[model samples]
Each structure stands twice: as C-alpha cells, then as structure tokens.
Target chain A: MRYDIRFSGSGGQGIITAGILLAQAAAIKAGKNAVQSQSYGPEARGGASKAEVIISDDEINYPKIISPDIVISLTQEAYNKYAVDLKDEAVIIVDNTLVHEYKQDGHKVYAVPITASVKELLGSAVSANIATLGVVNEICKIMEHQWLLDVVISNFPERAAENNTKAYNLGIDLAKKVME
Target chain B: MEKKRERKFLQGNDAVALGALYAGCKFYAGYPITPSTEVAERLAAWLPKNGGRFIQMEDEISAMAAVIGASLAGKKSLTATSGPGMSLKLENLGYGYMAEVPCVVLNVMRGGPSTGTPTGPGQADIMQARWGTHGDHPCIALTPSTVYEQFSQTVRAFNLAEKYRMPVIILSDEIIGHMREAIEVPLEGELEVIEREKPACAIDEYKPYDNSVLVPKMASFGQGYRYHVTGLNHDEYGFPTNSAKLIGLQEERLIKKVEENYDDIVQVEHFMCEDAEHIIFAFGSSARASKDAVLNLRKKGVKAGLLKPLTIWPFPDREISEYASKVKDITVVELSVGQSVREVSRAAGGRCNIKHIYKVDSKPISPVDIEKAVEG
Candidate 1:
C-alpha cells in the first residue's frame, strides 16, 4: 500500500522537518520504503512551503505525489493552496487557531488548536510541528507511536527534546479526542 | 569478515558530497547557487575536517578554474553549480579538457537560458553538458535519479575523470539534488576508487600530452616533473605546436580515449524490455517517472518498458540503436523542452518512431504525463 502525505505551512514553521521525521520513522524505524521532498520559494521565512512524503510497502518509483492521501496545513493560505485536488477520502488536519477557513468537502477534516495548544503548554509555538506529527500518526496509525517518537527525539537537540516530547504526547491526546 | 553498510537518510546533494569524500576527493572549489549549494555547504563543513581543502570561490569561472588547478596539482577536485553558473564555468571546463586536468563538475540543474528559475528543476543542460564547452572535445557526463545513485554515480564520476584524464560532469536536477531518501552508504574500501596514473618514467622523459598511451601518466605540478599546461593545442612535449598533423592527432586522441573505452564509460538500466514493444527513453529524475509509467502501463496489459541512461554523455547510441530495432516506438521524457530527444532521435536513426514528453515550467513530469503521451 502507498500513502502520500503532505505538510504545508509558511517557511520556518518546520513543516518540512515534520515531513522528514515522518519519513524517517517509516523508513528507519518501521523498515518501510519512504521518500520525502519539499518545495518553497527562495526565502528563509514567511513564504509558502510544502513538503510531501511517500511511504510504501513496495518500491517507490515516482517520487512526487500525484494526489496526497493526507494533508496537514498550519496556515489558512497553505490550506487553501494545497487542500485542492486531494483524494476524495483524504484526511485533512488544519490548525484551528491559524486556519479558520477550509472546505469540508466529503473528506475527514479536523480543525485542532495545534499552535495555540503548544504555545499554551510550552510558552512558544516552536513545537507545533512535533504536535502535528503526533496528531497525524494517531489518526493515520501509520507507524508505532514509540517508533515515531523515537525518530522525533533523535532529530532535536538535548535541551529541546523534553518540550518536544510533551508536544508530541499532547498531539496524540488531541487527535484521540477528535477521533472520539 | 563482511563489512557493515550504514544506511542513513541523506539529501541528494549531501550524498554527492559524501560520495566525493569516499572517492578520495581532497579539493572542492565552488560558487554557491540554489539547488546545488548544499553540495558546497556539506563539503565546506566536512572537507576540512577530513583533511581536504574547500574554497568558496568569488565566481563560477574562478571556482571551475580553481578546481582544474587543484586537480592539476595532484588532488581530486570538484565544483558544483546550477544553470547560470554552469554557463560561466564552460570556458574553464574546456580548459580542463584541453589541458587534460582530471576533475568533476556537478551541475544540479535548475531552470534554463539565463537564471530562468533559480529554485526549480530543469534538464536543459543536457545538451550543454555534451557540447557546453567549445570545440570537438570529448565529454563524460552522468545523470543519476536516486539518492543512492547520486552517491554511487558521483564516485563513478571521479573515477571516470581520473581514469579518462578529463573533466566529468554530473547532470542532476533540483528534485534529485534536494530530495531526501534512505540509502545504504558503502563501507570504506567497499567501492573501487581509481587514482590517476602517476609518471613511472624519469622526470625529464615525462610527456604531459603523451599520445603513446590513450591516457598519459600525470605528474603533480610540484613533484619535480616540470611541464607546460596550456589550453592551446600542444605537442607531446607540452609545447605550443603550429603543426597541423600534431594538432589533428591531439584532438583525435582526446576523442579516441573516451570512444575506445565506450563500454567502460557508458551505463544504462533496462527495465522490463525483454519482450516489450514500446519503450520510454529517459534519464535523470524523469526516468523515475518513466519507470512508474511503465509499471502502470504493464498493469493495463500494455507492453511498455523503460530505458534509463545513467551515463548521459557519450550518448548510449549502441543501446538505443539495438532497442530501436526491437521496440515499436520510444518516447523520450525530459524536464527540458527538447534537448535529449534530438539525441534520442539521432541514435534511433528512424528504426523506431521517437516521441517526446517534456516540461519547462519548473514542475517535474509525472507518470501520468508519460502515460498520457504513450497512450495518446
């Protein structure tokens, strides 16, 4: 089975990093084939950025996503730009605090306070990406929760690891509530 | 004891940098450009730590010249750039060819003409790689699609340059350069690394431009073997020669070295072509889409196959000609408007119909694109 996931947000929001971590969890921890790619303007920040990750049981030939199976957007602009042409059954999770507008066109759409929750808990929205990863994994069940968390911990520095861990667990809880 | 191969998730440009280190490349001189800048960045951090030299040259021309100079001084050198930078390096690249300096030039191609798209991918440099430099000079270029091939082909690029005694170009695009994938990094001593043949004769008897052998033994500039190195056509003794016979022989020998060892220099991957009637001819990242198209077509019971050239230059004429005779038609897919298709047409020689599916809008051609072209 092939699953293509896209993460969209403004640059410097770690959208690409979230995509990479998910790919790493699948490829390295779960022993699956995965490919991750990103597209962005030539800016360090504030421009639209999107990253796509393909996880598969078989060899991946075409690297880019033809149609994403899951879409995660942190900003309304990013949501409107990439949420189009998604698969009919595609799962979309958008940040409720930042993205207030989205089409719920016969697809599973969850608007969670992703950035606000992280900011409330950790005093900053820096770990919103990790929280989003947690929410996506909980909803998709793509890999073992511990495997994904392990990959996430390995990516960040030591001092920031604790807060990121809290953010991830918070995301899982948020996602479970949404499913409930 | 079997050595362990470490698998790591690496970007394509980072893989190229690591591959260069594995191939014993000790000098890197490059000017930064998008899509290809990561190569220089990684080398800048790693090259010095590994006891190698890295220089961020002021401009692309100087970077190319510095690489050629470093290689002439007995170091395996490399330079990375995109399209405009590639254009700037062509003049010095030709010098590397004429002077027989062994170095690698990697073009992680971005969109074309003159700074067309700084961050987008393009294969327009396909023709430029083959005939970018002036004159009847021979070229060896490799196009790798996967991150693994990016690493392996880069090592191969260095080996080809050192073995052939000329500049080798790696035509990678932004997608392949920036994309990240898991790859099994070869263990040390696992891959064959070829060093340039050093002079075995007396210092005075060494001929920098020796035609007695297809590839003459090279001596380091400071190794007490003094010889002239110039872009001008010179004789065996490395002296400027106006003699028509010597100049003619010089050019022929330059071309003959690559042509004589064609099999050793050219590589291609044939997927599902055993009994296939239709073929998709592609290279670089476009080949990845072609592979997907072939598989999808096969599912629908169509006889479609993929012929991907890992070695882009020294065009795989022999392979194309043979496939043209076997296949009903071949569709060439590239990111450029139409660069490699002309070569595909020339190599097919009308034995099979040649079609083209190309894109220049900075977006990669998808499998659907290739499938539509083949079916239509």
Candidate 2:
C-alpha cells in the first residue's frame, strides 16, 4: 500500500527538509520504498513551497501524488493553498500560532501549537519545523520518536545538536499530549 | 557473495550524478537550470573529491562544446541542461554528430519552447530530441520513466556513447528529475564501466575516418594519433574535401553506424496488449499518466493497454505495426499537439483507428482526460 503525505508552507518553513527527512526515515531507517519531491516559485525565501512524500512496501510506480492522504500546513497561506485538494477522510495538522483558523470540513483537522511550543521551549521561532516533525511522528506512528530525535541530531552538526534535541523533545511532548 | 545493504533514499538528480561518477565520468560542463541544476551542483561538489573537474559554462552551447572537447582529450565528459538550454546546445550537438565525439548530455526537460514553466513538469521534447540538431546525422536518445531507470539509463548512455562513438542524450522530464526515490546504487567495484575503444593501428597507419566499420577506431587528441578534425566534409585523412564521393561516403557512414544498430538501439515496453482491443501509445513523462489511465480503463471493463517507447528515436515501427494489426483502435497522448502522433500513424501503417489527445498548455495530460478521449 502507498502512503502519500504532503507538507506545505512558505519557503523558509523548511518544508523541503521535512520531506527529505520523511524519505530518509522511510527508505533508510524504516527500510521501506519512498519517494519525495518539492516545488516552489523563483522567490528564494518566503514563497510557497510544498514537499510530497510517498511510501510503499514495493516499488513506487507513479511518482506524482494526485490526491494526498495526509496534509500539514504551518501557515494560513498554505492552509488556503491546499485545503481544497485534500481527500474527504484525509488528516490535516495545522500550526496554531501561525495558522489562526483550520478548515473545518470533510477533513479530520488537528491544530497543534507548533511554533508556540518550540518558542516556549527554545525561546526561538527557528525550531518550529522540528516541532512539526514531532506532530508528524506521533500522527504517522511509522517510526520511533527517539529515532526521529536521533535522526535530527545525527543529521545536524555537533554545535546545533543540543538546541535541536531540546526542540525535538518539546515536540514529542506536545505530540504525546495531542495523541492522548 | 553476500548481498549488501538493500535500498537508500536518493534524489533523482543525485542518482544521475552518482551513476555518472561511477561510470568513470571525469569531466562535467553545465549551466545551472532548474530540475537539472542539482545534477551540476552535486557533480561540482563530488567531482573534485574524486580527482575530476567541473566547469559551469557561460551558456548551454559552451557547456556542450566543453564536454565534447574534454571527451576528445580522453576524459569521460557530460553536461546537464533543461529545455531552453537543450535548445541552445543543439548546434554543438550537430557538431558532435559531424565530428563523431563520444559524450553524454543529460536534458532534464521542464515545460516548454521558451522558458515556459521552469518549475512544472512536461515531456514535450520528444521530436526536438530526435531532430533537434541540424542536418541528417544519426543520434541515440534514451528516455527513463522512473528513477531506477534514470540510474541505469545514465550508465547505458555513457556506454552507448563510448561503444558507438556518438553523443547520447538522456531525456528525463521534471517529474522524474526532481523526484526522490529509493535506489540501490552499486559500489565502485561492483559496476562494470565501459571506456572508448581506441585504434589498434600505429600512428603511421592511423586514419580518422576509414572505410572499415561505420564508426572508425577513434584516437584521443593527445594520445599521439594527432589527426586532422573538422566539421566540414572530409576524406579518410580528415582533410577538407569538396568531392561529392567523399561527402556522400562520410554521410552514409554516419547514418549507417546508427542504422545498423537498430536492433540494439530500439527499446520499448508493452503492457497488457496480448488480448486488448484498444491501445494507448505514449512515452516519457506522459507514459506514466497513460499507465494510470490504462489501469482505470481495465477496471471499467474496457480492454486497454499501454505502449511506452523507451528509445524515442528510431521509433518502434515493428511493434506499432504488429500491435496495430491486432488492436482495433489506438490513442496517442502527448504534451504537444501533433508532433509524435504523425510518427505513430506512420508506424501503424494506417491499419487501425487513431486518435490524438494533445495538452499543449504546459499542463500534464491527466488520466481523466485519457478516459474521456477513449469514450469520446
């Protein structure tokens, strides 16, 4: 079975990196076949950026994701951009701080205070992407929470590891509360 | 022997770069273009560590020229470009054909004729790829629909370039270019690399274009076979000749080299066409959409299948003809209006009913459109 997921946000929101992390986690760590792709306009920063990930047990025959099963939006602009494309039963997780309102319709919507959670823990907005990953990890339940923490730490350099770890654990805590 | 690690996530462009490096590509010349720039960037960072060189040319023309020049200097060379860049490189592509240089050109095609949609995906370069360059020179073009095929076609492109002493174009569209997938790349020693076959004769007996085989035993520029080379019509001694006999002979040899290798050059993939009544013909990125459409058609109880041309050039006439004789109706879908449908009609020998589904506004031809075409 193919599990297609999409992350959409402005360019600086690290949407592409999040997609890469999913592909790496699924293909490398979890040993499943996965494909990831990203799209953005010419604007170097602050433009709309989207990253798509498809995970399957066998080969990925079709590369494009026509309709996504899971959607994540960190900004209101992103939520407005892809809210209409989600399937009726698709799960959507939106950032509460940046995204004020969630589209309450056929989709199962979950609002997580991603940026607020990270800002409260690290006192910075730069780690909101890490917090979003915490939400994804709990929602998907495909990989271990510690494994994602380890992935973030191992993938990042040594000096940034400690702050990233704190930000990641904060995400895990937030996600656990949401899931419970 | 034991099996190594199975699969790892790799960006499609990264796979092409790693595959080129593994195939002994030492020289890379390219101008950065979207969907294909990552290939140049990766090679720029990786080639240096492997004792190779990477040059970002001023334009696509120079990129193509530099790769041809480096290959003549006995270095395995390559260049990457997108749609507009590929158009600019067509001039040098003709030069490579006339001069018979062995090199690989990777065209990660995005939408368009004039910088149409840089970030979008389309496979509208099929006809341009086969007839892009000027003149009647022969060419080999390989189309890879999947990322796995991207890795293998890269190695195959280099191999064919070295084997036939011609430029091979790896035509990949934006969908497969930017997509990331799991690929099991072979370690350095596990892959068998094919280098160019040099002349067996001594310097005194060396003739650049002899009447031996269609492709003469080429000697590298600095390898002591110091021979005359020109794009103009020339004799076996490589000297400029105005004689009709020499020009005719050179042209014939150039065409014959690729013509005789048709059996080895033509590649196609046939889907459930054994007992099918209708056929959908497509290639490159559009082939994936056709595959989806075919699956949906079968579910609806319509006997449909797909015919994907892996080698766009030397169009698969035999397969098309045989399938046409069997199937009652055929539909051709493409990003362009009527470029490939003409060839499909000719290949079918007009034995079956033919329909065209053209989407030329730089958008992908969806399966919904295909199903509509079939019903209409």
Candidate 3:
C-alpha cells in the first residue's frame, strides 16, 4: 500500500522529527520504501511547520505527499490549513485539546487527546509527538508499533530511550481505549 | 562486479557528508547557512574523528578561501552554503576558478534575494550558480534529486574536481538537502575513489599552470615542488603573462579541461521519453514532481515523459536537442520564476514548441501542477 501522511504543527513540537522517525521505521524496520520531506516558515521556532512522508511497497517516484491519505495536525492552524487538501477517504487525526475545531467531512476522523494523554501517562508532554505516533500507528497501520519503538530508541538520545518507549506504549493504550 | 550493500534511511545533507568522507575528503570549511548548515554540522561531528579537519570559517568568502588552500595543500576539500552566502563567495569562487584548485562547493539552495525565506525551498539560484562569478568560465555542477543521488553525486563531484583540478559545485536545493529517504549506499571501500594526479616530473621541470596537457599535474606546497600561482593570466611556468598568446592559451585550457570531457561529466536520467511527444524538462526538486506527473499522464492516455538532468551545467545540450527533435512540445518545470527554462529553450533551439511551468513563491511545484500544465 502507498500511504501518504502529513504531520503538521508549529515548530519545536518535533513534528518533522516524527515524520523522519516514521519513515525510518517503514524503510529500515518494516522493509518498505519511504520518503520524508519538510518545510517551515521563516520563523522556524514558532512558525507553521509541515512534514510529509510517503511510504510505499513499490518504488516512490514523487517524494512528496500532495494529496494526503492521512493528516495528523496538532494545532488549530495546522488542522484548519491542511484539512482542505485531504483525500476523500483520508483519516484525519487531531489532538483534541490543541485543535478544538476540525472538519473531517468526507473521511474517518479521530480526535485524540494527545496532550492530555501524554501528561497523564508520561508525567510530561515533552514526548507528545512520540505518543501521537502511537495513536497514528494504531489507526493507520503504516508500520508495526514495535518498529516505531525501535526507531525512537535508536534515533533519539540514549538517556530518553526508556521514557520514550514508555511514552509510545502509553499512546497505543490510549488509542485503543478511547478510539475503540 | 560491483559489490552490493545494505540500504539505510538518511537525511540528504548527511548523505552528502558521508559521500565526501567516503570519497577521501579530509577537509571541510564552511559558514553556516540555512538548509545547508546541516551539511557543515554533520561534517563537524564526523570529520575530525575520521582523520579529517572541519573548520567553521568566519564568512562564506573565507570558507571558500580555506577550502582552496586546503585542496592546494593536497587534501580533498569541501565547503557548503546557501544563496546569500554563495553570493558572498563569488569573488573567491572566481579565484578558485582561475587558480584551478580542486574542491567541491555545495549550494543547498533556499529562497532568497536577500534572505527571502530562509527555510523555504526554491530553485532560484540556477543562473547565479552558473554565472554568479564575474567573467565567463565553464563550470561543472550536479544536482541530485534523491538521497541515493545525493550520496553518489557528492562522490562523483569529488572525483570530477580532482580529475580536472577545478572546483565542482553540487547544486542541491532544500528539497534534496533536507529530505530523508532510504538509500542503498556502498561502504567506504566499495565505492571507487579518485585522487588528484601528482606531478611525476622533477622539481625544476614542474609547471603548475602548464597549458600543454590542459590539466597540469599539481604538487602540494610542502612536497618541495615550488611554483608560482597568481590569479592573473599565467604562463606555462605559472608566471604572470601579458602576451596575448599566453593569455588566450590559459583561458582556453581553463574552459577546455571540463568541456572536452563533457561527455564523461554530463549525465541525465530519461523517464519514458523514448517515444513521447510532450517532454517535461526538470531538475532538482522539480524533476521529482515531473516524474510523477509523467506517470500520471501516461495513465490518462497521454504520451508524456520527463528528462531529468543530473549534471546541470554544461547544460547537456546535445541530449536535450536529440530528444527535443522528436517531441512536439517541451515544458520546462523549475522552482524559480524562470531560470532553468532558459537552458531548455536554448537547447530545444526552436525545433519544438516550448512552454514554462514555474513557481517562485518559495512553494514547491507539486506533480498536480505539472499535470495540469501538461493537460492544458
């Protein structure tokens, strides 16, 4: 399957890193080919940020995600801006606390309480992106959750390895408990 | 047979650094610039530990100068920067051009007239890259569209720079510089590496600027072979010359060295253009989208194709004309308002109908844009 996913948020929320780790999981651990590209406004720290990942079983010619199969927005600005370009059957994932308003008219929508879940489960929202990754993995099935864990541990700092792994598992639990 | 290697996911900038290291690059001096600072950052992290030197120069001009100095001292050297920095580097780039110092300069382009959009992607430097420096001199520039090409092309850039004893520019935009993708890269020893030829003649017989063989063999300063190297027009013995014959000879050889080997240096990838009518000529990020546009058009019962120039400079005019001769229409898609389209028009030479699909708002030209342009 060719899955085109976009992770949109304000910078420093690690959305770009999230997209990169996801592609690494698909390509390195899942044995699928993937391409991840990102763009940010001039004000890199607080500006609107977007990272696109395309994972395919076959060769990927276009390395960009023009018409997204899935859109995960962690901010109202990101959600409102990117919602119009979603695929007809796209799965829209949003952080309920941050993105209070969303329009997912033609497709499956999951308003995940990503910030609150990370706060309750991990004791801090620092790894909020990792927790959101778990929610997306559970719904989209882009790659195995185990593969995501492996990517986070290998790519992230050694000290945060244990907590990040816990963060991912907590996300999976949240996804199953709430979205089910 | 070439030994195959395992594939790994890597960012484009990291791939360039790895390729430089694998190609025996031992010196890196650069000023930080957006979309390109990662190239220097990666080199800084790995270069020193692997028997290389990484220096952060005060500015782009100093960075270019340091790379030239290091290369002349017989080390494979590289320097990376973005649009404004590249502009600041034009004088020294011209110095490297005239002095014929073997080095690689990476311009990981971001949008800019003067810091237009630092993090945004644009192909605005196509003309600046080829003509940024004063006066006319032939340049060798390569644009890699994928992470695999980013790695392999950087190695190729080193090989070309050393073989010709001139600076080679790796003109990568933000799209390829920052994108992360899975690439099958051969290990250090697996890739074929080329080193600059050392002079075999006696110390007294050496002529650093000798026009006899076009690319005269060079010996580093400490190697005991002493010779003069001035930016002014020089003679066979590297002495400044006012004689018209010597000036003409020096200018001719500087351009001829790369131009004569154009066949070997120029490379392009054709996507289903063998028997197509509408040809989309693209490079860098535009080529990636154009490839998808070509595939989509074929599925729509249209005979659309693409020609992606991996080697951007020297223009690959012969091949562009060869394929353009049979095509009914040619569309040049580039990120700039219009830069690469000029080269396409010049190469197509009025044999076919030429059209332009350009975007200069710092937004990437998606495949849908190209498809719509072709359908219209």
Best by lDDT: 1
CA lDDT, candidate 3, residue B310: 91
lDDT of each residue in A32-145, candidate 2, tens digit only:
888887777767788667888888896665566778888889888888886556677788888878888876667777888988878877788787777788788787676877
Instruction: State candidate 2's TM-score.
Output: 0.95
User: What is the Å distance of residue B201 in model 1 from its true position?
Assistant: 1.1
lDDT of 2 by residue, B1-376 (tens): 9778457577778888988987889999999998799999999999999989999989999999999999888888999988899999999998888888899999888877798888887677877888988889888988887777788788888988888888999889887888888888776667667888898787889888885667788898888887877888888878889999989999999888888998888888998887889898887678877888888899999999899887877778888999899998889988777877999999898899999998866557888788788767
Clashes within 3 Å, all models in order: 0, 0, 0
Name the top DockQ candidate. Answer: 3
DockQ of each: 0.78, 0.60, 0.82
Q: After the best TM-score superposition of candidate 3, give how far the Cα of residue B342 lies from its true spot, in angstroms.
A: 1.9
Model 3 chain A is weakest, by summed lDDT over 10 consecutive residues, at: A39-48
Model 1 DockQ class? medium
Better of 1 and 2 by DockQ: 1
lDDT (Cα) of model 1 = 0.93
lDDT of 1 by residue, B1-376 (tens): 8777988988999999999999999999999999899999999999999989999989999999999999989999999999999999999999999999999999999986998888788999988898888999999999999999999999999999999999999999999998988999999888899989998788878888888789988998888898999899999978899999999999999999899999999999999988889999988889999999999999998899999999988999999999999888999999988888999999999999999999989899999989999988
